[model samples]
Target: MQTIVYDETNKINEQAVQWMEDLLNFAADKLNVAEHAEVSVSFVDNAKIKEINREYRDKDAVTDVISFAIEDDEEDLFKEFEGSGITIPRDLGDIFISYDKAVEQAEEYGHDINREIGFLLVHGFLHLNGYDHMTVEEEKIMFSLQEEILRDYGLKR
Candidate 1:
């Protein structure tokens, strides 16, 4: 999978960036996504994430991660391309992660920063793959899948 990661806040070091890439690749494999599947991940600070949450979700609060799924529409476009017998990669979506919140949460959750980052990435990746936690059952299912992927990736928490 093509995981384009950007550190917007300059807080993520090279090691963290490498971890994110590795986690993303593992997540793609767990989700059964093809190597051509494309996803963009951005690391931002709490202020940036809060602004995005307020603008898009009207939450006005800092969140660990946010995902925008563009695959459905892209799938339709891909079908049209298929008519022409031209294959195209899938643009899954964008994932925004708040490094500040991740640090805080990692401390709160009693896990390492890598585990926290992996959890956040997996959670966001599932959303890009059409998972949701709007209800208790949905939350359970989504959380279970997230944990499963993380555990398999050796990021148990």
Candidate 2:
């Protein structure tokens, strides 16, 4: 698993970025993602994320994190490539995290910034893998899997 991280706010340090990479690789292994899968994670300020939320989700409020899954749209495209003997890295999708919101939520949830970021990353990764919390049962399953992943990754609240 290859996780490309872009800290648009320039507030996150190298250590945190590396930690996120390691966490994502661990999560990918646990989730049975292909070894050559690729994902991009961007850390931006609340303003940029709010703009994205408004544009993509039609929500005016600022959210903590958002995910854009490539497979959601091009599932059949990949299936065509599968049996063609072409080796291509699976582009999972993109994850945008609000750095400002992360700090706020970390304080609100009584956790450190790393923990909050890890939670957000795992949540976004799950979304990329077709996990959703739109219904009560879905929320339970998704949240439970999130907790399990976090616990296994040594990031617990």
Each candidate structure's TM-score, on Cα atoms with residue i matched to residue i, is 0.92, 0.95
RMSD of each: 1.6, 1.4
Task: Summarize candidate 2's per-residue lDDT along 1-157 as a digit string, tens digits.
Answer: 9889998998988888889999999989888999999999999999999999999999999999999999976547467677788989989999999999999999999999999999999999999998999999999999999999999999989
Which residue pairs show collisions in model 1?
none
> Candidate 2: which pairs clash?
none
TM-score of 1: 0.92
lDDT of 1 by residue, 1-157 (tens): 8888899878778887787888888888888888888999999999999999999999989999999998665446555566686667788999999999999999999999889989999999999998999999999999999988888889987
Model 2, 49: alpha-carbon shift in Å? Answer: 0.5
Off by over 4 Å in 1: 73-75
lDDT scores for all predictions?
A: 0.88, 0.94
